[model samples]
Target: MKKLFLGFCLLVGIATKAQTVADQPFLQDSADKFSLKEGEGNVNLLQVGSDRNKAIKVLSSQGLMLLYEKNLRQDVQYRPLLDMNIVALTEYQGQFVYLTEKAVLSNAWAGKLYINHGIEAPKAMGMGPDFLTLVAGEGNFAIFKNNQEVWRSSIESLNPISVQYDPNSGQFLLLTAEGLYQVDSVLKTAKKVFDGSDLTAFSLFEDTIVLGTTNGIQLLDRKTFTLNKLDQKLPWTEITSVNNIRGNLWFGSTKGAFKLREDGKYDYYASKRWLVDDHVADIAEGPDGSVLVLTQKGMSKIDFEPMTLAQKAEYFQEIQRLRHIRYGFTSDLAMRTPGDLSTGYFHDTDNDGLWTSMYLAGELFRYAVTKSEDAKQNAYEAFEAMERLTALPDLKGFPARSFERDGYEVGLHANGFSEEWRQQWEKENGRIWQLSDDELWRWKSTTSSDESCGHFFVYALFAELAPDKEWRDRAIHQIKIEMDHIMDNDWYLMDWNGKPTAWGKWNPEYVNSFPINVGDRRLNSTLILSFLQTAYHFTKDKKYKKGAEKLIKKYGYDENANRPATVIGFVEGEDLSNKWNHSDDEMYFLTIPGFVNYSFTEEQKAAHFNAAKSHWEVERSEKNPLWNYLFALSGGENIDSEESAWWLREFPMDLIDWKIDNDHRKDLTKIAPNFRSQTYTEVLPGDERTLHLHNGAYRNNGGSDGKREYAPYIYLLPYWAGRYVEAISAPQAE
Candidate 1:
């Protein structure tokens, strides 16, 4: 039986109020999970019309497809129409209705809707209850009901564009290039509804006729026959299709798709996440609360399934173990064929230790919160992987970035840099791929501060929380080795070449080399000081504490650490400071736990927590749960969790790295482009934007062209970390 250490419990109370919550039993709100099913190919989706019965009528170049879908199951039956010359299709009385060039036909209707079995080669048609109406020539309108041509009228003023049926008023609405028109088939008359120019699409919602044009959207009230232009901004304005699926207005535009929310803000769904192509041709209601979208290529269905965060974590864990693990380390999946998971292979990347460290940290947090045996086992396995990183390097506490078979990646050039360039960079510092003492394997070298930061943070968590004595001891020993090496090397993580690896330098000269506006100065200061404090806290080593004091008192490292995130933007002529480093944000938030919770003095703890809060002030708009919960370690009451939970709920269930775009969206309040890439006044919801884990910019518009897939360890880290700190409760079943 394993138990949380009492010393760690006492340490929590002594430092701050981070883990000081009683169990929350009645926390019941949950979020939905998304599942995207794509029907993708080269064929264009010409039009999407409703099916009166149980299936959908999708007219495309390939043929007419009756798409039947329910929950997780879908079936599509195609009719090539090789034997029949068909121009258009619709459903009439539970049977297929074909509008061929010669005649109007259906399997069930006894006679043609048009009198004398004649049909007009019209611009558009609208079919509804008791009537079939078509706009012929400029303004000739004809309606047929009960197998009779009820009306044939000519309105000289209207220029015809498109026709749609309004179910509420039992009337047909028509759009025009110059104005809007309405037809009362029962009354057998056509009249001008409203005056508008360049009208492209229209959909009926209650009394309002929502019209779309090249400029924007407008609403026409059926009773008043007066049009009121919709004042809301849309994602795109070159409208192609407008649909009201069960009262919600869905617009398909030349750029992408969007839905008008009740609050007047549009929920934009663009990129590969929602469509096969951004040139959406049609939008319609789908089966079982799903949204069906038709693009130039094909159709896609987006389903929202009700689930809690806890359930999501379990599902993520299962997939992470099944497809993401390589040699006990969390790894990347490089697709041999782009966009195909079957063609994926577990790729040994340069940050295997860093990524696995994060995964291990999350598992440890899960074990701390629930004491789950499986969580413990997961932590142990990942810990072993990271342990191998330290031992394989053969440099005391130094850890290799990753490892693979000897011949696996000897000549691989990654990060889009050329082989020649990489060889020169490696030669400048040291060898990057070091062959192991054993002939069968090789380990990576020149590890960065980010990798070391992840290792230190997770190792401290394991040493303090793991109940297995051997694991805890090994964790502490690694910390001592690393901390001692830094002290012995004059505050530098030295490589075998007797020089500091480019980014592993933390000496006073290196740390102070850049101007105060640069980030590396503040970041390196915080990292080494926190490393010492955590080492001292864990092993009660006086030398570690003395080393930390020497840096703080003499070199002013504490003051530098205290302002790590502030003044870290847009330093002139400095390449490192040209943009915000999201990787630095990740490292800072992850390492803040050890810095605040394991400080040597009460004064140090408070100072560290205040620094963290300062950093979070800038990061709050990002809505990252890990940053929020880690900052909550100060047990501060000022933190707001609404945005954090919003991010969690909005995270996409599909983790594929599909190419995404948001730059064209009109709904977003865009700002002048800057170094931080905070492109908009407000961030788009998670599913609508890029899924680069913690690197999500507030309004990042585009990234990733379907060549890779992330493991989603990003979600797990924050979720379990929140649970461990009681910022999040257990899953609440409804």
Candidate 2:
């Protein structure tokens, strides 16, 4: 009995060891904590801080008028004797307020008092105990505090910009177009801090006062009044404003938003969208070091829990592991169970589309490449099941629509628009169009039929990885069909129902009309490469290379000639001239470098690689990581020292940052305190349509192009670029 017990214990110990080995690679786990709440108005301060209980808010209601107070457990916490509402809130010893209309200054703890004003109209305002100042456009000025008039002094160029206070040192500072001034609390006087320093704003923290100008931020030791230049280089950033949260300070710059770490190092942050025009108005730290933010349209949050050194090491190992994982599949296209048939949690029932198949295929490939055998097996089964489903006779033409029982195609359903503009269209005449809820499928047909090229690429990728002839043949046939039907002689992929020629002729309800025929060349090129690469693996044909060459030539290699010659620069906000749809190009660029199987001269390969580089160079920035990820992938495969160094320098893990809670704006630089990228022009200010790449921009007017937006394509960009880590951030190979 003792011998038998010892043997069983040994078996259990081995099993335990195996399980530990499996779990070791899986790291970087995160769970969703909170759903965002909606708010309105010129929310000046949205404090989502370390103390989660303190959900205090302050916002402007009537331009200059303000409303503020923290939500209390029982009753409203009122400011004593302050009848008129507060316009702005700041901290000196505690929370202080700047009231509009009555010219009253008050504190949350201290009682309120009216300040004497010398001028009839106050254009710019700032405060200091026993002192208050107002500027009226030109050199006109007023100074008062503590309900008493004080001596006022002004020069020709003192255009007051911003004011801030340092509590620990008991000092008040004001910024103007000419220079910075130190306000004496006792004497009620203003003195210049430095000469020839035109100021924009000042950032105030616990013991830090940072002065911002066209040059850069100037840090001052509040206690000693010692000056230290934070950034000496002019145009290092075009700082619009500065914010304080917890022990850190943040800068909203023209290039992007950055967070100053406790150690005084800088890191960028965005809400994971495009905020080219909008400024990161304010930040509120939340539970577990998470931050709540307010931008122009709504609020957004980000949780940053510091990773330990061990975690960092694990992350690097996973990165190396991604290169080693090999992928394969069976040659037989036949299957016992349909790949689309699954009892999984995320199953789709809509039979018409290949959304579910593409999703599963992408997920499986991602997992498989990361060395997850279980996920690999699952992915294989998914593809096999899809093959079986495709074999169904009635569903053959890769029909645009599919029905479970009747096996019939459902025509497009439309909801009539309230406006007369869209009502003229036949598709938009009457009923509301609702897509199927449950559908397990893959894209196949290249005709006017609604199909996903994603399906073909997914199958082709599997075939290439595994060396399957049958899969390779199917991919080739599909590629030919795609080329003949949608791809024009110029290498541009036609949008809307396989129409290879002019816009709106083939399909009326297609996307953008202008160069709409060009579409996302990245996607077209990626899919073509996938087919060419896989076909080469099986047949070793130079014809595939010839075909790819033709496409490349027509499209100008990187599809630059096809895509609009513009890239949105979000220095202040998203520059609309640059926000062209390029997800397709992004995907193509990512997979182009992996075309090692194809027969090509070194010159040809170099040309293709350079084309991909052009796309990356133009689009790459802090806000957009899809481009960065693709750039890194291409760099990794090519093994070019310069490219690798470039990626490491610019697109580092800690370096990629996004703004939070910006409404869908194309340009982020133009909009202030509304991290969303918005477009602004001298003619029509704050036009989101011209600026952003969303539903707001592309509309279904009576024009050739119907109602559609490019934003959805933006989200799918990561898949084609092979930037899988950014998608799931999975540390494990699986």
Candidate 3:
């Protein structure tokens, strides 16, 4: 008996919180708004002026340093006082004042350092207009004017965390772990305004006080003295310091830094993109709206604004140029890198035809949207590459995995080979083909159903959209030959050995053998219907329609098409549906356009749409940009325009398959391991997950190709398609 799996209940426990306008104020946009500078060691404090024209000071392990904010340069231009054991630095009444344990530096204006005598050693200090309040051990507090003691007082709290003076309130605020207090300048009374334990940091706004505690941020209403908690959770709970910079709240925490926008949403910066270390010591707003982040490793300046769509389009175009010149072709065995294109090393890929077809489709959409000759030329070149795959194989209409030069056979290994397979290649002269006059070109055999789906999908698009008559005629011819071969071979893709390819079975005997709930049964049924409908529409063949109707009526392929994908954890046993195959999801969604566009009747199209909708609903949790774009193009419900834009922006500038490990991050919220879902509360999968895993199994898999880099097509396809479908608006000039 097959193990039973629970379905929708699993999702109910893990569904993401509803996104409200108040909660998600910022639409996640991508742009170059941040830059980093590595200091000698950890930076402990940063101070900048409210005016955008002032110089910023940084205190690190190296010593006191200065950085100019004129052009956002990262160079450390001045070290006024180096190798000094400085306790605190502050600006009081337009004058720079800093202190050490044994000495006091007073009014060190205009690059000159001066010492002031007659002031006792103070543990902490707060600056006010023309005066400074010093706090020493044992609750000793004193007010000094021009280095002379004017008044003195005593308080009960021995451990004071920080001291700040609010000009509007005309009082000094002292923060302690026990509570917050307001002290007047007369050397006497202290008023306890709010009582809170475990207080780490506090920042005073005009009428409110923001406190950072072990829980999260707490807002104190000074007039009412009532405390209200912020519902927005930080990436980590241990909030270290809070700074109110021009109305924006910057929360520095143990894990990273978060900036809460005025509109109530937040932006996070951490882990190499904006921070050299995760531990944020302090945060200060720079002169030109940039933020200076002091971390354990160094300081990073992040401009918190998002990028415009025009900039994103330009970025995508540049990536395309780099990829086409460096990593465009492939040879044999789906080796991840496919050889470096820049240095003249080329290899074959098992699905070069399939992958290239998707890229070609993207270019077709780009051409349609922009009317750029460059896009048309790119589509034409990719079409030529795919067409070569079908011609290089020995079987009349079978497509080869890939083709390459004859001399490069160093690491070629076929998937499931027996002695007969080796004999066919070495003795009987089978499986390999020489296409060039000098016999320099060779092609690998054994094409699967994935290649077939890609071929038909692209061919249908070419037939409908290609501007040149020659291209349209070639597409139709390819479609007719491939469909005829499959039908003639009893609905299976026959390999060069006269045997059906392992994944090329779509016949009734194969598809119907699986149970109704199996993923393969549903996936194969949807694909075959799409293939038949496409062939009939392009070739105007009645036999193709007849085969489709036979499958729908006799074999319940239509019912299979409408069956919803199982919610993985709900099912038990080793069922194929128990795990998610993102590859199958890609094939399933890619086939929908052809299936709906070429259906024989409105009823048939409606059924395909319903199936597409059901599949997309299950897939929405993945937040895949490509899947969302395709679903929107197919007229699915609740098209996520904001999310699609986010995916394009969040896609890393580097397409190289770098090893990313997020399992060790402490800030992440671990959910029950579900093999079908990639959703996590800490970060989006697109931000940290591997590109290959987007189409592979989600569990027990060491995600990503460690040796190779991905091409730009992964981003270009969805971006162009979204542009063509008008799901994404054209970016305006800034």
Error of 3 at 634 (Å): 3.2
TM-score of each: 0.89, 0.44, 0.76
lDDT over C-alpha atoms for residue 614 of model 2:
61
After superposition of all CA atoms, the RMSD between model 2 and the true structure is: 14.7
> What overall lDDT goes with each candidate model?
0.72, 0.39, 0.64
**Candidate 1: residue 204 lDDT (0-100):** 77
> Taking the tens digit of each residue's C-alpha lDDT, what string does model 1 give over 161-188?
6677777777787788777776787666
The residue-level lDDT of candidate 1 at 129 comes to 67
| Candidate 2, 1-734: lDDT as tens digits | 11111122233221110001111222121212121224433334322222223433433332221212222111134434234544444433334445454564544434555564544334445655444444232454555554666556665665666555555546566667566677665575667775546556666776667776666777776665577556743213556567676667766654445666454445544322323124444444544555544454433444454443224433433332232111121111111232211211111122223432333444444453455554455455545545443343222223222222222222222121244533343243332122232443222222221133444445544544333456546644544443333333233333223323221122212222223234332334444554454444445656656666664665443343224323322333323223444434333443443432232455544555565566555443322434444344333222222322222222222111122232322222243422222232211211111222111222211111112111112222233223232222233443
Q: Quick one: ranking by TM-score, best first?
A: 1, 3, 2
User: Residue 211: error of model 2 in Å?
Assistant: 6.0
Report the backbone clash tally of model 2.
60
Tell me which residue pairs clash in candidate 1: none
In terms of TM-score, the best-performing candidate is 1
- Candidate 3 to truth, TM: 0.76
Model 1, 634: alpha-carbon shift in Å? 4.4
Candidate 2: list runs displaced more than 4 Å. Answer: 1-53, 59-88, 92-163, 166-170, 174-180, 185-201, 204-241, 244-358, 369-389, 392-456, 460-734
